[model samples]
Target: MALYKQLALGAGLAALLSTAAHADLSGKVIGFSQIGSESGWRAAETSVTKAEAEKRGVDLKFADAQQKQENQIKAIRGFIAQGVDAILVAPVVSTGWDEVLTEAKEASIPVVLLDRGIDASQDLYLTSVASDQVKEGRVAGEWLVKTVGDKPCNVVELQGTVGSSPAINRKQGFEEGIAGHANITLTRSQTGDFTRAKGKEVMEGFLKAEGGGKSICAVYAHNDDMAVGAIQAIKDAGLKPGSDILVVSIDAVPDIFAAMAAGEANATVELTPNMAGPAFDALDAFLNGGTVPEKFIITESKLYTPADNPQGEYEARKGLGY
Candidate 1:
């Protein structure tokens, strides 16, 4: 009888160990759908996210959406089909996300938005970790207003992707900043797809339409990539950039700091690219059944000018590792 009791106890212990091993979440898989490498910041985001997941022992399944909304949707669905524990998305556009997010919710998997946001119901996703894009634009606009004073500045704007949240909110906030200043007018505005090539093409058109840069006082771009492109356009047309045409933009990329140090660009709003750390922190909590606030995270940003663009700081802030 004592021998039988010992055998039963050993069996129970073995079953408990098996259960614990099955429930161990250290090797859980996470799905990450990234918008394609559009700029320096985007590339940094991708690198950091992968590194963080690997460090945390997460099997990260990644997909590149190539800057297309449809591609992101397909990737999200694929993650769901594969039964990943959680999913992360940096949406290419704000709208058209509710349907796929609903699918994720139905699958009992949590979703986290990275740099960009979606215009879905709050309950559909876990949380968003991103900078306040509208505020970034407002900061840039305020700097322009103070610097240009009451000087009737005719502005040429370089917008981002057509339907992205950053482009829309940045334009809205900039318009608000210049609202009471009747002398500040946006003479020409066009989408540059947030790329250097497109920004240059659109700026060339603006220069021609304004009769070789005499009519424009400043250029406000949604991101530094576009601003850099516009600066090249100004130089190619035989005009000095900062002196001939003032430039203000968002995303304080390393290249933009170099431009500021060279006096080619005026100001930029800093959009830090280290979003993955905070995202994984939040995900860990949610997956562990901890209660997460609906709007759990937000990244802070600041404005950078030539005076503040120190050499060491510029090098350290180049790519998003923080």
Candidate 2:
């Protein structure tokens, strides 16, 4: 996340608030509720956010929700009790956020969402910092369509946890990308829970069910870690991954770039872990000058192909907590 991700309070009550002219955030304490280290990108996000907070002289109080809405709710309440300047959350799910957000609002605390969004009203939070998940899926889908040409292809999908915003929106984008291409059919679809181990296990099942990868042309995963696992599964099934079955997914983690350099994976859409940058900027502007920032701040969803210098990308992100 950077200054480029956010807009100035586009709509809603956030737009009506005036920005303060003076900015001084030193010695201010802030509470952050992370969605846990569920993926490589999430772990990196935690690392980056902490580093950014230190640079800004902001005391960052962190809480890991372990992917549970109840845990997140409890953490928010605790932050409210502490009366921190603001609260940041990377939601585990979309629903069940109204009550907690309302509580934050009542406390006069600005709540900022990171990475994923919740079903609660936009008025409840200051803003959300995230990437365009739907666009990520569309990019992967478009790449596969171009690589396969007019050849009739059957695709097997490894989706993230069921009902998650990324999973649902990514699937929608994929469908939109290949809408007119009847030759490309998503054959067997299943959830891999967005983990390397589960991705491998589910991919094995997909190989067995698809007649040993004979009918499947490509594999699309919701995250790069899953795609990496699926690649290993393809190899263990006595098949070449890059030539036998194409690989493409989202979340441009360091491992995914390594896979691309080795030609095991085809492409990945980046979900940058630097979301804290924009969040802190908006918070600073709001507190210093009463500036009402944009309700939604979107980060980049960059597509990295093998030709985009995979080895270079890998070296660049490896030390960044990926």
Candidate 3:
């Protein structure tokens, strides 16, 4: 009888908590600091964030930092000054946020990290929502491992912006995934700045250096956009992307799906842009007396291959502005 009473009380309290959370966030103001729309993924993220705020009836104040750390810091201070209810920052660079985050902590305005994390004390922010970058790389690596099997594979990697967390973690993850694969090796690697033009230029140099692209077996780009650019480079050198040289990358953007459908690319790991949906959920829960969630809330890192209906995937993402 005592156990039953405890269970009934617990249920009641849970329902009460749910009600409070739902009530606390209606029409609340949220400030979001985004790393500028440097890529299709970032643009989609910004769009999705706005849609989420509208759906929840929350007033959202957005700032784009133009891919600079100082601009991001300035935006954060501006949000704090405006007395916003909560702050969401997808930090441009990881290290320089301790002081600004400290100010937010002192003001008692809970700050949540969206899509990217800052290098700071955990207590400074409410929680972080992001994709496991290393895992994304590992997924790409694993696919190539399975595809190549026992064949000797020489992979040339096109890394993202140097020193960015995604570039760092993703490279580490791919290395970890291919650790024991003796038949596969990374021969040459360079930074593409996560841009198509740079990816193409770097790949052109790699082709010239590697016996007119014959010495290379595969291309491992940090993102699908780069892989698409690399495909053009391979074709210019009289090599077929899927047959003569395999192409694998992270971020399943719509262009990548088009590449896959046309047989110019092999596989990609997805990095969804719906980061704000989870961020808002965590913010609401915390504002209504719920404990801060697990520090790291990882987003999905789904893999898409040509065999999984590339045309359908392309069509789905086309309207999403990717």
| Candidate 1, 144-245: lDDT as tens digits | 899999898999999988776678888997898788998899989999987778889999999999999988899999878889999999999889899889
Check candidate 1 and list the clashing pairs.
none
Of the two candidates 1 and 3, the one with more favorable TM-score, higher being better, is 3
Model 3 per-residue lDDT tens digits across residues 264-322: 99888877777777788888888876767889888767777889899987887677655
What TM-score does candidate 2 reach?
A: 0.78
- Report lDDT (CA) for all predictions: 0.77, 0.81, 0.80
Error of 2 at 159 (Å): 2.8
Per-model RMSD to reference: 14.2, 6.8, 10.1
Instruction: Give the Cα error of residue 13 in candidate 3, in Å.
Output: 33
Error of 3 at 63 (Å): 2.9
Evaluate model 3: give its TM-score. Answer: 0.81
Cα deviation at 172, candidate 2, in Å, is: 2.2
What candidate 2 gets wrong by more than 4 Å, as runs, is: 1-27, 65-83, 92-107, 162-165, 205-215, 319-322
User: TM-scores across all candidates?
Assistant: 0.72, 0.78, 0.81
Each candidate structure's count of clashing pairs: 0, 10, 0
Model 3, position 173: C-alpha lDDT score: 84
